[model samples]
Target: MAAREILADFPAGGPRGSWPAEEKAAELTRQGQPATVRMDLASDRFLVVPVGERS
Candidate 1:
């Protein structure tokens, strides 16, 4: 297994759904970091990580 570096995290309880996480990933991508979001069911949060860094 590979280790994924987390760039950011958003709570799953956000009223705006996953929009904030998506937007953050997009902003990171535009900034040249190339990020994406993944759900952590156990922790109940959205994780922002670099592309290809899926756990």
Candidate 2:
């Protein structure tokens, strides 16, 4: 699966249009943030969101 870094500029509260799910999760963790995997049925893509900080 594809992955990206979680940017501090990430929009809060879920992804808006055309955003990947898995990459989101991977990025969140990569950035030392807690995140959960999410699947977008509409785009058939996975995403991740930060649940908390690595602290």
Candidate 3:
């Protein structure tokens, strides 16, 4: 499998948790680019990555 590039990163367990990352991913989705949000427990940070084909 190919490695995914992280589009954004934010501190996890924040005032709203992963909501911030989710919002950024939603914007990317609205722009027609598939994306996802994940949390890194070790790093205590949220991550956003683009999915599917890369243009």
Candidate 4:
């Protein structure tokens, strides 16, 4: 499978849940870079990547 370009990452342990990652994705989308959030279980972090990207 093709590797996705990660736009940003946030710790999964954040007290605010996934809000930060989700907000980042939304912001990127509004900026024309359409993005989404996915859980990186191995790294225990939230990854912000382009829409349709898969691990």
Candidate 5:
């Protein structure tokens, strides 16, 4: 898959209607990677994964 990142002040999880925060975290972990943060434009909230935990 293509590595896509937000250029705006977006968070880490995933894009809107793209993927769930928890699901992204799981996917990253499954891929031997880790997640960091997430931004919900609709909710105007940020989802942050703790260090060494989610990412």
Candidate 6:
């Protein structure tokens, strides 16, 4: 399978924490697509990506 692409990046804070990423991932999953949250190289950012099928 092809590697997933980053859909968005969310910064850690009082409002834009990992919640948005999580919500987006969940929405994708509900639509039969797999999604994931990953930390950037510096470990200071959250990235949401589509992982194709659930498998």
lDDT of 6 at 2: 54
Q: Which stretches of candidate 2 lie over 4 Å from their true place?
A: 1-31, 52-55
lDDT of each: 0.91, 0.50, 0.79, 0.92, 0.50, 0.71
Q: How many angstroms is residue 15 displaced in model 5 relative to the true structure, after the best TM-score fit?
A: 14
Over 9-51, each residue of candidate 1 has an lDDT whose tens digit, in order, gives 9998988444889899999999999999999998999999999
Off by over 4 Å in 1: none
Q: Model 3, residue 44: what's the lDDT?
A: 84
The 10-residue segment of model 5 with minimum total lDDT is: 2-11
Q: What is the C-alpha RMSD of each candidate to the true structure, in Å?
A: 1.7, 10.7, 4.1, 1.7, 9.2, 4.6
Candidate 6 residue 18 Cα shift, in angstroms, is 6.4
Clashing residue pair totals per candidate (backbone < 3 A) = 0, 6, 0, 0, 2, 0
Among all candidates shown, the one with the greatest lDDT: 4
Q: What is the per-residue lDDT of model 4 for residues 9-44, given as tens digits with 9 covering 90 to 100?
A: 999998844489999999999999999999999999
When 1 and 6 are scored with lDDT, the better candidate is: 1
Q: Clash number for model 3?
A: 0
Whole-model alpha-carbon lDDT for candidate 4: 0.92
Task: List where candidate 6 sits over 4 angstroms from the true fold.
Answer: 1-4, 14-18, 52-55
- How would you encode candidate 6's per-residue C-alpha lDDT over 1-55 as one tens digit per residue? 6554787777755383339878878887898878887766565777877774231
lDDT of 1 at 41: 96
Clashing pairs in 6: none
Task: At residue 15, give the lDDT of candidate 3.
Answer: 88
What are the per-residue Cα lDDT tens digits for candidate 2 across 1-55? Answer: 5554333332234546644455666666787876765444555544454564221
TM-scores for the candidates: 0.86, 0.37, 0.73, 0.86, 0.34, 0.62
Worst 10 residues of 2 by lDDT: 4-13
